[model samples]
Target: MVDTSDLLPKTPRYLKVPLIILNTILWLLGIVLVACGGYALSKLSHLDDIINVSLPAGIIVIGVFFLVLTVVGCVVAYKEKLVGLVFYTVFMLILLVCLIGVGGGAFSYRNDAAKPIGTAWDKATNDERNIAQEFFDCCCWTDANSTCGSNCQVVNETGSVVPNLNKTTCNITVVDYVQKNLYVAGAAGVTVGVIEFISMLFALFLIVRICKNPRPKSYD
Candidate 1:
C-alpha cells in the first residue's frame, strides 16, 4: 500500500511524441520490406524484373528493422523500469543478430551473383568486337519487316529477343542484368525478411513487458 509515485521520474513530454513517431515509422518500414520481399519472391521467374523491382525494396525494408530496434531500445531506456530495461537489452541482442544475418545475406548474394555477371559482361564485350553492330541491327526485331541482323538475337529473361544495337542485345543484356540482380536480391531479401521478423519479435517483447510491469502512479 506504500506510495510508488516517487520511485519513477515524471515521463518527459518530448519523449512520447518521438517514440510514437519512431515506432510508427519503423513498423511501416518493416511492413514495406516484407511487402517488397514478397514481390521479389513472386517475380522469381523473371530475374531482371526481380533485380530491378525487388532488390532495393528488400534493402529498404530490412534497413527499417534496425531503425525499429533503435526506437524500441530508446523508449525502454528512457522509461527506466525493470521491464523496459529488460526489453531494451533483449532488443539490442536481437538487432545484433539481425544485422549480421542481413549483412551476410547481402554479401553472399552479391558475391555469387557477381561472378556470372562478370562472365557475361566479358562474353558480351568480347563478342561485340566481332559483331560490332549486331545489337543495333537487331533493334525492333519484334516489329514486322524489320531486318537488321541476320543472326537471331539472344532471348532474354522476358523471352523477348535482344533488340539493341548500341546496348547489349536487349534480351541477353536484360537477362544477364536480371540474373545478376536476382542472385544479389535473393540473398538480400532473405536477410531483410529475417531482420523484420526479429524486429517484430522485439516489438512483441516490448508490448508484453509493458503490459506485465506495474506503472508508477502519477501523483506522489
Candidate 2:
C-alpha cells in the first residue's frame, strides 16, 4: 500500500537535532500536566462549583493534545512523511489559537475570578466559616466581624475560651487570593503562547525545506 512516488526530505542536523530535543521536553511536560490535573480533580471534585474546575480540566486537555502531537511529530521527523508533517503543522497552528484564546479569556475574567468564592463564603455554614477563618487567619465574613465562628471568639459568649478577633475579614482575604492567582494564570498563558509560536515556526520552515529538496523514494 506504500506510495512508490513518496520521497524523503533531507533534514539539516542543526534543525533536526534541536527539534528532537524539544520534543522530548514537550513529551515530559505533557505527562506532568495530565498527572497534576488528574490529582487536582480527584482531590477537589467537591470544589467544582466553588472554584473554577475548568483550569484542571483544561490542563488535561492540553496534555493529551501534546502527547498525541509528540507521536505524530516524531514519526514525521523520522520517516520524512509529507502527509504527517502537514497534519503536525496544522495542529501547531490550532494550538497557537487555543493558547491565545485561553490567555485572553483569563485576562478578561481576572476581576470576576473570585465571584464564586465570595458567593461560597456568603452561603458557608458556621463550621465552614470557622475552617476558612482558621486558614485565612481572619474573622467572620466581612470587616464587621459580626459573625464570628469558633475560629474567632464571640464577645458575649461565656466559655473557657478568650475572645480573639482578627482585624481582617475572611471574604476579602479569600477573594484577593483568587484574584491574584487568576492574574498570574493569565500572564503564564501569554508567555507560553510566545514559546509555542516559535516552535510552530520551526515546523513551518521544515515544511519548506522538505518541499525544496525531497529525495526520490528509491534513494533511501
Candidate 3:
C-alpha cells in the first residue's frame, strides 16, 4: 500500500492572522488612550482640588494594561500557547467590563458638565470673575445683566473693536469648553470599548480554534 500520510495537507497558518491584526489594532488604541489621558491630566491639573484626579489616572492605567495585554497576546500567538491564550482571553473579558463602565461614565458626565461649571462660576469671587472675563473675553456668567459692567468692551479676533452690548457670556463659553473636551473623551472611550469588545470575541474564537488544531509538539 502506498503511504498516504505524506499526502495529507498541513493546517494553514491563516487562522492566527486575525489574532495578530486585532492585537496590533489594540496596541495602537492603547497608545491613543494614554496620550489622551495624559493631555487631560495636564489640562485639568489646575482644577485638581475641584475635580477628581483619579479619573484621568484610571484612564492611564487602563491604557498601560492594554499595552501589557498586547505584548502577552503577541507572545501567545507566536508560540501557540493554549494556557497563555486562555489567560489573555479572561483578562480581555475583565477589561471589557471596565471599558464599558468608563465609556458610560464619560458620556453621562459630558451631558451633565454644565452643573459643575455653573457651580464654579457661582463660587468665584469678584476678582476671580474679572480675571475669568478678561481671559475668556466674556462679560458675565450668562449675560451682561448677570455681572458685566456698563462699559464692558468686546474685541474680535481681528483685533477690531466691537460693541460688548450683546457679547457671549462666560457661562456659555465655559460650558462649551468643558463639554467639548468631554465629548472628545467620551467618543474615544466608546470607540475603544467597542473595539475591545470585538477583540474579546476574536480572541475567544482563536482559543477554540487553537485547541482543536493543536500545534505540533517539537522534541527539541
Top-scoring candidate (lDDT): 3
Clashing pairs in 3: none
Candidate 1 whole-model C-alpha lDDT, 0 to 1: 0.48
- Model 1, C-alpha of 93: deviation from truth (Å): 3.6
For model 1, name the residue pairs that clash. 33-61, 48-178, 135-164, 135-165, 136-165, 162-170, 162-171, 163-170
Clashes of 3: 0
Score each candidate by Cα lDDT: 0.48, 0.66, 0.71
> For this target, which candidate reaches the highest TM-score against the unseen true structure?
3
User: For all the candidates, what are their Cα RMSDs to the real structure?
Assistant: 11.4, 6.6, 7.6
Error of 2 at 61 (Å): 1.4
lDDT of 2: 0.66
Q: How would the candidate models be sorted by TM-score, starting from the highest?
A: 3, 2, 1
lDDT per residue (tens digit) for residues 147-185 in model 2: 556767644555555445545876677677656755665
- Model 3 lDDT tens row, 97-164: 88777767767877887787677666756566666666566767664345543345567899975446
**Tens-place lDDT digits, model 1, residues 1-220:** 9996544324432333444455555556566656656665555423332133444554555556656665665566356345664665566466546555655665565546545433433344323422423422323212332232435446679897663444334334434444565565555445545544554454444454445554568722
